[model samples]
Target: MSTLNRISTPLTELTGVEHPIVQTGMGWVAGPRLVTATAEAGALGILASATMSLRELEDAITEVKSRTDKPFGVNLRADAADAEQRVNLLTKYEVKVASFALAPKPELISRLKEHGAVVIPSIGSVRHAEKVAAWGADAVLIQGGEGGGHTGAIPTSLLLPTVAAAVDIPVIAAGGFFDGRGLAAALAYGAVGIGMGTRFLLTSDSAVPEEIKRRYLEFGLDGTVVTAKADGMPHRLLRTEFVQGLEGAGKLAQLLPTLRRTVQFKNMAGQSWLELARDGLAMKRSSGRSWNQMMLAANTPMLLKAGLVDGDTEAGMLASGQVVGVIDELPSCRELVDRIVDEAVVQLKAAAATVRSA
Candidate 1:
């Protein structure tokens, strides 16, 4: 038997995973193969289902089951018109966790817990965290401004400890986390664990295309730009020519391409015009974004798909964090998790020794 010291936290106990490191549900990046690899490596790997159809989500869940019995999660959009149907699929597959970008309805939370699925919502503010915790969220993953994809303005160093102190439920700190030192810092902030997106995306086990991953490696901390133009939300993306054009273009200039990608996304997702409108309306109501912004939302899936899945850097936008600068190698999930845990243990021990000497 191996004798590596394993670290446990409220996150591990809640998710039933061996480590508190989580491969966040990054669209296009988190899929079955990557989830399986992360799961086998003893971390919680969340399947990104926001880009999937209901059928695709079920199929992906089944595929993951065939590959490993270890615990994993599915990320869902609470505002999606078919949210209830997707929740039913979670119980149908006996999924271990249901993670959401928005605070799911209280009823959904109760039902998910009833079915034994841990409900963790990604929140950006203390108020949102408190709301979800009051709604019975098992845990909350809070992403700060430095995070990849859609993010808020505050960095994790400021937001994490504030949210952790406000909520009774376990808080998972995300944004700017990649190594054991990040995990140790999160623990020091009273967080249950650290959730990583760019870190996990750069892993060899990630399904992201090799060239795309290499492109990500080429960026430094200054490489990422948070532009609301991509999706009408403050989204942190790589400083690519495509994104730069987006920044420089007028609404009229971007309209045609945005509409084109919308149609492409509708066909790929198999969403009817009516379904698309309803999702957009729901998003508009929740986010208070304009109709133009609602239409702009279609660019996210296709652009990310083109970049992460198809490797067309010019046509695609790269979602990334500042952590991409410090990351140079693509380690496998097992190596990543083992080293993170090992290093965290050493860091924690050294701190304890410092206290005794003081």
Candidate 2:
């Protein structure tokens, strides 16, 4: 009845999921419906709480529970003003895993683990991975430069093996993973699972508009650009006219819209100016970003909302992985998960045969 036996790994055992694949929490893209579908399809589904208010997050969690009776994870902002409240919400709902885009505080990690939730943080470097493993993170998801949104310079092939060797905990690979061949490759590299964002975003269950999804499908390997102009960080995005304009325009020209989006995000997040400032200060302290970069950081959510939620490609940009070029069709979660698992089985068996012949 379950296809999980096809590929067993630490990730599947820890999360009690049938597969070792993960649907990453992309802001505005990973909502209740998509998360629920991913859960039902046997991969770990992570709800993106960075784009949600406290109440909205709770409701979304409850809705997912109503839809599926499987384990799932919630991705949270470690520096969020309501981080404690959100942790309490997860405890209240008995969510299985708690994920963070940034490294959570040591005390917070302790608190979650004590409450019977597994804590996994997304890291970009080996040192960061080692830091979290030392701090008692249950696992680490490593996303390389080819990943969507904010990313680092190291590619997955290099980053995965380096982090896997440095840390004793389970490693989940992200960036440029789309199918079963990638999964087999990750396992060979010592990763326990693969986390995917752009791949999952193209799924039929995704909340992104069909037209925006179509726009994403038109991309080739060269269709993506990693530019710091979007949010003062290295963000991989589809080469849209809007992003091109942002790249050409000076920082001064981008300031007004950035400020306006900050206000809009504040209202949407139900956070006051003082609260927003405090969060920014905390982010600045933790990340060591410049004041200018911190100011620009506020634009990320609003811009993502425009393209992902409103489907306004001209007004906002699409965050995508370099692997977007090879993906063509929109498959339902079940179809995608099953096909990947089946293909992985074939590939693994073929490799085993080659070993025997050798």
lDDT of 2 by residue, 1-358 (tens): 4455458899999888889999999999999999999999999999999999999999999999999999999999998778999999998998999999999989989999988999999999988999999999999999989899899999999999999999999999999999999999999999999999999999999989999999999999999999999888899999999999999989889889999999999999889899999989988988889999998899899999999999998889899999999999999988888888888888889999999999
Off by over 4 Å in 2: 1-5
CA-lDDT, candidates in order: 0.93, 0.93
Clashing pairs in 2: none
**Model 1 segments more than 4 A misplaced:** 1-3
Give per-residue lDDT, candidate 2, residue 101.
Answer: 92
On the 0 to 100 scale, the lDDT of residue 340 in model 1 is 91
Q: TM-score for every candidate vs. truth?
A: 0.98, 0.98
Count clashes in each candidate, considering only residues at least 3 apart in sequence or on different chains: 0, 0
Residue 86 Cα positional deviation in candidate 2, in Å, after optimal superposition: 1.1
Model 1: residue 277 alpha-carbon error in angstroms: 1.0
